[model samples]
Target: MSRIIRNLVSLALLLTAMSVQAAPSSFDLVGPRLSVAVTRDGSTLPLEWVPNLAEGDRVAIKLDLPAGQSDRFRLVAAFLRGAVDRPPDAWFHDTVSGKTKGGDLSLVVPKGAQQLVLFVLPERGAGRNAIVSAVRKQPGTFVRAVQDLNQAALDRARLDTFLDLLFRIGRQDPDSVNAASQVLTRSLAIKLKTECLQQPPELQAACLTGDRETLLFADTHSSALADTLTGAPVDLAFQLSATPQGGYGSYSSYIGVVRDILRLFGAFQSSQLRFVPALARMGDGRLTLLLNTPLSFAKPASVMVVGLPAIEAAKPPPLQAAAGVPLLCAAPDTVLPVEGAPLVYATRYAHDMVLRVAPDGAAGFDLPVHADARRGGFVLDRALPDRSAGATIDARIAGRWGFTPFDGPRFKLSDPRVNRWTAAPRASLVVGRSNAVTLTGEGAGCIDGITMQRGDAAAQAVSWKQDDANTIVVDVPLDKATPGTVTLTVTARAPAPPVSIVLPALQEVGRIDGVAYAAGDESAVLTGSRLDQVREVRAGKATWRPGALTRAAGADRLTLLPVDPAAAQVLTAGERIVADVTF
Candidate 1:
């Protein structure tokens, strides 16, 4: 044989091998054969739909369950007409006949349909994830997506048909759709249930829509679970103290959502959902005022924001015509510009919307935060304009219209929140006599582990517990400390796209030199160059906190004051030494 012929044959074989390798693992087998090949344990599922019903969009279902797992589980699907209501029976394969195209391998539906069904059947291991690949490619599969606030595009990252949200105050303007549109955006149309202008104070978020089959559900105004967090028995105090702007990192929005979920489980629950400030100005010519939440809301007509009489009484910031760039700031209290102002309004309450993520949160989009597979979560990092470290405002919601606030939080033409992140991230460590080491701002999602090695001293297993998701307290053994400084290190974990950050070794603080004082003592003076910090101090049987410290002589003389008088009780000499210092 000629060498040319041999080379040609080898090239042909290589091409054939590559093509076979490129074929997708799953395939569609839709024809007359109802009992086709089980196809490697139902790894991939193919489906189709044609508009055959009366007055709604067409629907289809595909399943890819493990072969042996669901031997008796037939494909059954159902939907929720409202937030809390659903039909008793599910539509089976018989309800909707299926037809597979002969050679092309496609499931064909009937004709002239108007209604569609999004099955809420997680138990079936079917629906969206099982079929979105083909569905997104199909001509008209009704993609489950979220439209951008700019209305320029839709985000389909998570293929869910709906999300739970709250209803806030609304407004009336030529471009009012932009406000609610901030939270209400999806590739598919949505019906938001929000507060209308029918009454003075809109307290509820349950207004009936015209469609008897469709129900709008949302949490009411007092939805914040702040009270529940205060007495949170769990060591989730790290989650409680975290500020929304500084602690949560990219998943700040997602953490708030998870915190709200924890709130529902906490002993005390509230109907109030937390609200964030949103600025929508697409550059048209009008301004629309709408309160924003991370959750989604629909009902454009029902969403309205009416400032209480107190908003006007606060002497809010004045509205200046085209005053620099309209900057939105989040203040502790609610304030707003006068009518005809082009700003947004939102009040600040101690919502604790911010949360601590693992140190590896930066890579959360891709890999697991830890090598041990101990945790998993996602981050919703919404970029904003000017992070002043004091406030945050996402301007993507800013449309072309002018937003006029009747009464709400103040919005100026010059507030800042973009650079806030530049100086936002900081690391802190508080040490104490109890040998408790508190890690602050250590991780992005969750603090996974801590190790302290004093020179050659065996990498001691310091027992620790999470004060919150972002903070952890590693209680070193009483014998671990000496009179000199020591080096300590930690590793934090966030969700993937995998990120792990190791903080610089923290230098230890030397022993405190002070007059002995009982835990019940109100104050104690220490003359030393080293001061140990602690989050909690226990004296006698009660919990006491060390208050602000005052130093004088060459920064050596220090005074510690106990703030909790209730914890003051007669004690023994054993409690006369220094207690933990609360930061």
Candidate 2:
């Protein structure tokens, strides 16, 4: 029996050497560059060759399973480090028969292992399993495995894939058992407090029972106690309880309960959630939520009741309104500085007066009642001297003053009289009834001279012509004098390039005395120094008859007159100046 054992051991050693010698080259040992093929069952398994792996090298074996299969399958890989005794870094259960599902799986191998083993299983049952086997390579096989797996990691490696998928599925199909489990895990992990958990039987239900009322209370009173709570701006107004498919109240109420619970739980985790269920107002009116505890770590206990007055009702009015006062005067006037103590009359009486007076004695008053009186009916009873009486009686009676008096009895003391008595200069030019024949110079400058029309036909009319240097003068008919003021406009030419006229800053010259003046239906007089040399006296384009021009031969003035009366009558309104001057 001893001899047989020795021979068997030698045979085993020979077979082991042959197997090692039969190992493929580094290129062949590392199979297909660790290509990952995702199976129809959603397992992403990597098949790679371990090159030159010695009998005692420690290595990590990574088996990547599809997103939802990591927790369900058992990962088994041979020739790996820390495989037999579970290592802290190992992501999969080493003793499990199949691989984990719901995420990617990884395992470490113990030394002296020859082949790698991997097993993948479905999430729920034990039947479906994907098996992967890989050969161990010599010399830095562990590092190579890690490198190859790192590249393949993207194929099945996602940190929150399972969680996100769980959420998506749960939202879509809340009744799914897998989705429920996922949601429960997520909720528990995040420590979310749901309204579903807070309700007590049917009576305590968030949506069905009066939980919605409680939520509304929290929202309306959020501003009052927001500072004291951990979370604020809680959007409790949205009908979160109602699902799209469910009836209005049913869906919103249900979702609202869940959302509220989540908010509360979020607050609890962040140390911010404050539940001070008091009273709050809705569009319909008020509601109350009874918060069981002042502050507690354990789940909150609360109840809701409709038609409760908000906490704001218990507090006094806001501080801003405290300063407001009701005023009581109608048509109040500001007190002004006067030489004498003038008795001013009020337009209407006030039961109580509230005045906001400025430093300058300008006062604004609020009226207690509407005034029903008309204007100018109430007058001030004050005496004035004959000289002081010249001061115009102009008064700003505050209560809707109009031109006409009111039909009611006049209040003599109600209207205030303002005295303005200052002498002003009389106008040089008056609008009505003047006997003097006024002739306005048209065109540029002031009128210098005037001449009377001479000839056989001129005796029939009273005609006095004015001489405006290089301009026309308006000839106002003295015999048939008009009552109103007649405006005579002259063509005021802008000065030549070298000459600029500086207009008087204080006084506006209404009409230029000379140049070319045109009045209604009367002959205009054009007079200048070189009147006879002017070939064409054109206003705009049409020619004008030359008016009498005084040609002085050594201080002897000779008047050259217009021979045509028809040409003089052609000059009409606006600036009538001679254009295209020849001389």
Candidate 3:
């Protein structure tokens, strides 16, 4: 096994040397059987399984090596944070000269490390810097290879768990089995083929244990799959076993099927059949998804959109797309195609739009690609903005070979007021003072400039500074202005409309005198500064709204007719008056 692994590594290195553009094949990398055991929080993961790593994780990597050839080679482990390679000194190194057929190296996963690369070189060949330089030349290939490795490891773990579940279901009593087993027997079994089961007496015995190879061939090569490969209209089942006349072929040994499934998953993780999801705000302000595909494979045979749980969910619920509730968010048998031209594919896919997660339990929508004369991509609908935070959408595209799943775009919901105000700049402002106000809300950071205009006067420049992501400070000069409305037009960064805030100025309205209600009087007399500015007045259980203010020569006075005349007329010292006044 070690010799085979060595040869595979040699082939990979040779390929890299021959062509800089050559992708590091996962097949070659997988042969090394690079098993990593991550020790985190005092617990060590099982061998050959690699989980997502966090900071402060200590990883133990064991590599199989050819016996006599060990002395001639050195294993270099490179840790990467995205495309940025870690310093050469931080990389792990081990000389493969052990008496045993295997060598082990231990290292902390390190802060911000998202990828790991392991390769063997001649002990005397290139120095560490030289190796680093080569990796820098094609960082994307190495990064992609690492992602594929991690995904393959995770998929293998899942497959093992699935097999374990099957074994448990067989060994345990029907009543004692778990919900997962119950789902398999009650819901999943109906989708299987009766021929595979062979009849009632042998249903559990023959069907549960079937030939994987024959089953895969039967399902994958069916008429529906053939139609899909040829770009014909066919409603194909998303899973292998769920297809018509198809089942997990009664595999005598489960190893072959598991390998096949892992390989399939590996291909999905690779860049070979590239599919990327993006978010776009159209001219009409519609937020959409841009499902970018390579020009060579631009037209997918079929596309399906799956609504996912809040992206932050630690464990998302299993996807169950029945016929009516199609994950595609369309009626059954509906065939949606890519809606952009090849040139649009070239121009649009170049963007670095990343997928974001929507809030948990947020509503999901279908995002299909679209294009016009000037712009082209998936146009996000209004539903996206309405969704709660952390919600995520996903998609599956069927190519000539098989179905490949990709993540859809995400959104962070914002107040709708931000949209209308930016274009017209209408918000309330107070007069007779220079107001230093801190504006805090969504899209506050987008405000690059602020201007204050009183009535029809020329726009006066205002000094404003961004304090944080959601806060901006603006100083409005209104001390000289008389009581009236002022429009504060706020300018956002390019592409966002400027918002106008219309401020109707009113003098301070809080001054108060005694409120008196004579037994024979028709209403109570309330006196205060800016008596006309008070919209409503509340005292004890009695609430009063004045029709209009009638001011005397001495003071501003208003007669308040209580809405509830039968309630208590007396006002407490604490609750003597609570008025709603506009500025």
Ranking by lDDT: 3, 1, 2
Q: Rank the candidates by TM-score, best first.
A: 3, 1, 2
On the 0 to 100 scale, the lDDT of residue 523 in model 2 is: 40
What would the per-residue lDDT of candidate 2 be over residues 318-367, giving only the tens digit for each residue? Answer: 11111221211112331111110000111111112121111223332222
Compose the digit string of candidate 3's lDDT tens values, residues 336-426. 2222111112122112222233234555334333321112123222223333332113333211100112232222223222423322144
lDDT of 1 at 251: 11
Worst 10 residues of 1 by lDDT: 369-378
Which scores better on lDDT, 2 or 3? Answer: 3
The residue ranges of model 2 lying beyond 4 angstroms of the native Cα positions read: 1-354, 358-423, 427-583
lDDT of each: 0.27, 0.26, 0.40
Worst 10 residues of 2 by lDDT: 338-347
Off by over 4 Å in 1: 1-433, 440-442, 446-448, 463-473, 492-583
Please list the residue runs of candidate 3 whose C-alpha ends up more than 4 Å from where it truly belongs after superposition: 1-35, 40-50, 64-74, 83-89, 97-103, 120-134, 163-195, 198-210, 213-583
C-alpha RMSD in Å of predicted model 2 compared with the true structure: 37.0
Work out candidate 1's RMSD over C-alphas.
27.2
Q: After superposition, how far is residue 160 of candidate 3 from its true place, in Å?
A: 3.7
